[model samples]
Target: MNETKAATASTPGTHAHTGMTTRHDTWWLAPLLVATGFTLFIVYATFRAFENNYYEIGSIISPFYSPKIDLPGWPFSPAILILWMPAGFRATCYYYRKAYYRAYFLTPPACGVSVWGSKSYTGERAFPFVLQNLHRYFFYLAVLVLTILWYDVFKSMLEPSFHFDLVTLIMTVNCVLLSGYTFGCHAYRHLAGGGLNCFSTNESTKQRFKVWEFVTKLNEHHMAWAWFSLFSVGFTDFYIRQVCAGVFPNPVFF
Candidate 1:
């Protein structure tokens, strides 16, 4: 009886470890690193922009920084920060709770620390694990914001005399980066989750759900998209800085 119990327990443990290894061993880590690096770079760039006396977004009355473009208000900076927050958090979704509880919270694992440091058992306030909940809300916001940014791009294009400068090119690249990031959101996968019966028990929802499921399969791999999107954002900002400093021309893509 004792021997049988030991064998059964060990079998499941082995399988669990194997599954984790398989998931983490894929090309996932590379993209994750890339995304993390990009996210850091963008944060640094934004800080630099403020430090370089370009923080104001078209408030002519303020004696702080002069306005470059006629921006509405303090909209630009806040929007950028808000939009990137989800991207930043989502990047760590793979094993975030474990990292937090281990690194800061100093919680112990039920089974043992897997890999470097992870508790086998989750804590009482499992609510944070509900980080999963942010996916859908962020998805809608990301999509909406991307559409608005694209509109800004169109507005930029309208001015024929506006120099096809590097700053403008960077803005265009930023749009693309945002789109990729938004499309790759986890909630997007849920939104794409097939087999819905909320509206009607017919094929309409089913068919759409099927399409969403395919997209979700791609979105299911959130870590990859997260990193890819991060890199693109950093590159976009870099391009913007180069243009702003007169280092490059913003050539329009044909």
Candidate 2:
């Protein structure tokens, strides 16, 4: 053990004995921005979930409140009943795990940086971290929620007579962006056909291969989809709140 320590200590590219890279570039900037953006989103989402009142305006219910459910005798926000599905899905997302692990936990911080636990480190094999495996289950739940959200968006355009408005456009874009993100999930890509050993096993397998290919295309841009969808959903909620508060004008073109 002493000899191994001596060798590690002798390594010159990283700081002595600490294993951290001695990069002179702005490597810290990425983590700083990621942490800041995540913090802002969390704070905004929490406030909106608890506030709950301005989430519904006519057929244009905010993404935060679609398929609205409030338990009997429940005193808190209805969003409590709805937010968990998407929130859990995002929290356990494969890409997001990398983001938070680096930014929040400083576990490597960036691609080449050495983490505090680089030695004897086990990735997601421990207690709390093991819960990340539930990402697949969360994907299932999020799909159900996304279905409801799509319905809500169409309802907004059709209900109380057909009309197109700024709110409708915003909600539509939010749902589309979210669909791209959710369908591009690593769990979803695997579910699409990752288990199959051959794509030409039969007619059914051939069709499944097509789905897998489509999902693969989306997965190529999963990171972009993830960020865009997040912004869209948050903006949808904010715009709805503004309309509810009479602070923003939502013009309709019928």
Each candidate's lDDT (Cα)?
0.47, 0.85
Question: Per-candidate TM vs. native?
Answer: 0.56, 0.91
The regions of model 1 sitting more than 4 angstroms off are: 1-39, 42-120, 123-132, 160-174, 194-203, 220-222, 252-254
Q: Which digits, one per residue and each the tens of the lDDT, describe model 2 over residues 1-254? A: 24454445434344543335545578779888889989999999999999868878887898888788868999999898889889999999999998888789776676555664435546789989899999999999999999999998889999999899999999999999999999999998899898889999999999989988999999999989999999999999999999999999999977
lDDT of 2: 0.85
Cand. 2 TM to true fold: 0.91
